[model samples]
Target: MTLPIDPTALAGLVSRQIRTGERQGMPTKIAIAERTYATDPDDLWNALTDAGRIPRWFLPISGDLSVGGRYQLEGNAGGVVEECEPPKRFAVTWEMGPMISWLEVRLDPAAEGTTLELVHEAPVDPDMWKQFGPGAVGVGWDLGLMGLGLHLDSGAAVDPATALEFPTSPEGMMFVRTAATGWADAAIADGDDPALARPAAEATLAFYTVIPEEGTQS
Candidate 1:
């Protein structure tokens, strides 16, 4: 499928970061991704929070979205809205099965446009961290950010079929590979050994781009 933007250029749009931190005294790893959208803060905020608009770029979401309410992202994570500040920021608990994490999204008016920053912090699973680094979640958000950009630019929903097929496509593979490398670099900057981070990035790339055989799960 044809991508709405250049794969490499789209991959470069996000700024990635890794922060070593703690939540409730438990060691956690934070994955940060930021991008500037050529739209006003209000529009960007609406696109992010409006139920009708969410599936256009992100996922099908259903629930009461106000503070302390619950929300589920169809087949993905479900959580409670912890805080909400219109056209500015919001925080939520990101829970998938038994695992729980914290997600905060902030929108700031910038000279060029509105900058969207997503911060995802989860307790570290040492083995998973050693295997995938931040790219496990980072690359997925990279795709979401890419979809948002396309939706915002075209003022329309990104084709769901294309979005689903992207990761294993040649262009999608390139984007994932590039995003994984960027996350690895962020990990390295955050003091993870380069030797380990590089391999972890490769593992991340494989995880995202590998296609499963028919009737099998990925």
Candidate 2:
């Protein structure tokens, strides 16, 4: 299930940022990831907004996608589409269990291609943040962005089973470690203590690439 590309190079392609903000009057932590894809805005937009094309790179999604409509990703977050601007931007509520967060994706023309920016904002959980920093979710998005890049380059769907097994693969672990470290660096730039943030990044790496016993949870 190892990707055909250099995991380190692929992990380096993204830019990460950590922002402190307020959401619904509560303190929030925002993780932003940006990368440019080698495709025009129109083509990239279609690949993102088209339901039939979504599962090619990410999870299978179901539900309405228009403004105010609800959508669900299989075994993952489900939320309402809050805004939409074709070939430019879209926003949604990312809800899992009782926790609700905001996710927005923006696309713009870049010198090389179309730049995709993903912003995820959520109310901070002190213990969780202390244990994993932004990489808790940032690393997951990094993996998704990598999948998107592969799909764009190959013009084909990534193998679902392989993707599911990827995190435990040698190359997948390498990619996760690199991306997690990147998130830690971004957090440090945002005022997190370097000593603490580095450990959190290691925690995030373990969370993503660890394989659990057959009868126990991770």
Candidate 3:
């Protein structure tokens, strides 16, 4: 299945690569994505901070959501809440086995809506990032934002799996295909070698294929 690509949407968001020194001579690198929603910052904050709303779009998150509080995601990763500022910003440790990363989300108000920014930093194996590229998190976040849009605009509860599955539908495939191309473009813009970006995009598309194009595979 190929998905339609929204180059403008992908390009509008800001993504940064961070390098942190904590592992001997190796450097930790991360990529961030930022976007604005047509909703108030407070509303956006509730959607993220409210545990009940999390599973509707993103993962099933369980945590105190306060500074220094620990949290967990069902069947996924878990870690400690590093920082929290209601209606503004929050940070947490994202742990999956040996990989420990930090994810920070910030919210701000705008004339049209609310601005949402996400930053994820960790010591990634260079080869892994080369294979996954931005789509590793980009696709997931896209689904999350789509759900947020539904909730804010129409009070709809989007099934997380369905949101992810949409990209495999005949129409959805077009979106995924286009999205893959967009990710490739973003990677290139972020200074990834063309040679690396193309393959990385391909790998990301392949990862999504774990669910069959017909939406039967789990």
The lDDT values for all models are 0.94, 0.94, 0.69
Of candidate 3, the 10-residue stretch with the lowest lDDT total is: 1-10
Q: Give the per-residue lDDT digits (tens) of candidate 3, residues 14-76.
A: 343433345445566555666778888888998988999877666788867677888888878
Q: Can you list the residue pairs that collide in candidate 1?
A: none
Q: Best by lDDT, which number?
A: 1
TM-scores, all candidates, are 0.97, 0.97, 0.81
> Could you give me the TM-score of model 2 versus the true structure?
0.97
Model 3 shows how many backbone clashes? 11
Ranking, TM-score, top scorer first = 1, 2, 3
Q: Over 4 Å off in model 3, which ranges?
A: 1-25, 213-217
How many steric overlaps does candidate 2 have? 0
TM-score for candidate 3, please give it.
0.81
Candidates by lDDT, descending order: 1, 2, 3
Provide the global lDDT of candidate 2 against the true structure: 0.94
Candidate 2 wrongly placed segments (more than 4 Å):
215-218
